[model samples]
Target: MVGSLVNSSLVGCDFSSSPTSRKPIVLAHGARRGDVVALSSIEALPTLAAFGEWLRKPGPWVGGFDFPFGLPRELVEHLGWPLEWQACMAHYAGLSRDEIREIFRAFCDGRPAGGKFAHRAFDRRAGSSPSMKWVNPPVAWMLHAAVPLLLAAGVDLPGLRPGDPARVALEAYPGLLARELIGRRSYKSDDRARQTPDRLIARKDLLARLETGQTRLALRLKLTHPQRDALVDDASGDRIDAVLCLVQAAWAEREGPPGWGLPPDLDPLEGWIVSA
Candidate 1:
């Protein structure tokens, strides 16, 4: 069921599969008031247990989390994983990280050079990394780490599974919106040495466009001066990415339920990214 957005807090999470004090999971808490999405606070969870604890808390909230929610259907079938969503997730969660990496590596090794990893349908649409990639962004590990927790927390994953209707969760990719605002110009880097002036300018330009409601979502970002500074000053882009996901959550909430602006043809086995 589509829960009442009027009373729901909109959340956007920039998740880290393996979180630490140095690089915690960042969550942006916000709500929509008419055309304006006001960011209220940003917080960090330093461990996966803390992240799970936060998920299990009471909710009349909708969240757009920056993590792959499902594996590619092709990959699952090739690996002979369960076809059923819940069952497949359970099988996946039972595997150790090393096992996962080995299995995925085998699959990739058999594929042609450029088309190494299998991709969910939405991956091409969203321009996201293949969910099976274990390095670089390590989104496969992200899915491995987060999905079970989401399932355990009993949050409603719109297309794939049903649980607490009030605690809705959607896959989000900030790059989708960021690219819309700034094209391909890089706006953030975890390396302090690479946090150049150009990236800082890019962040400001992106924020300016977002503040003016320049994207297709048409939702203005309402932030205090300090909030704006906090978002821009973080070279890692975790805070801004969380806010970007927050914007997507606001869009989904505004769209209301059933699909929540997700396509009617969304694959149940692979899941779709919100606002993709």
Candidate 2:
């Protein structure tokens, strides 16, 4: 906590590429009351259109969104893309997914085994997936799909774009918070059958830690019994991730005047993850 967050609402979103009912985007909504940050509601957006509409809604909110904000500078420069953020994004959006894959694959092919993916500075600090990783997490595609919408929505992304100051958006990674709570413990699995007892226990422990104010962000989380159960019961981890991001948003709201908790030395081209 760096400042008074007496007047802001918080949101955390766990995003998916092709969101369906089975894999909808989870949006966790929360607000601070005294020392406790209470999770008030959750919204599921089943389509990109729905998500776009939700984002454009008026608000004085600080949202922590789980997606890479920019490509690795090395990758961008190597491909001779424009250095300007908006221009680079425009160029990126114009390319087909297959074209992106081919370009990234060629870049990886010449690199060493452990260095196949180029990383942003914030990724190094936060232990985030490489923004260029197209498969596995497919953050590259997520960035491609989400950034344009964010731009269109005109929400302010600190160090990236200037939009509506009231609706502030920050890059957030729930894994960073999860790792702090339980190092290398697997708390989620997309496979239905693999959602085991151990992961459930981990989720419980994480929720406990959050409620007790055990992280760098010094605010306690307040959840109703049903809200706690809902977060634990969903073994896919999207719900918990959204909550984690919501807490991160709360942290950001109090972290600084206008940087959204990002470091002052942050790279303009490579956005910083909130609370990283």
Which one is best on lDDT?
A: 1
Q: How many clashes (backbone N, Cα, C below 3 Å) per candidate?
A: 0, 0
The digit string of per-residue lDDT tens for model 2 on 196-238 reads 9999999999999999999878989999999999999989999
Off by over 4 Å in 2: 1-6
Instruction: Return the TM-score for candidate 1, rounded to 2 decimals.
Output: 0.98
> For candidate 1, which ten residues in a row score worst on lDDT?
1-10
Candidate 1 residue-wise lDDT, 1-276, digit = tens? 364555999999999999999999999999998789999999999999999999999888999999998999999999889998889989989999999999999999999999999999989888999988999999989999999999989999999998898899999999999999999999999999999999999999999999999999999999999999988999899999999999999999988886788899988989999998
RMSD of every candidate to native, in Å, equals 1.3, 1.4
**199 in model 2: Cα distance from truth in Å?**
0.7
The most accurate candidate by TM-score is 1
- Can you give the TM-score per candidate against the true fold? 0.98, 0.97
Q: After superposition on all CA atoms, how large is the RMSD of candidate 2? A: 1.4
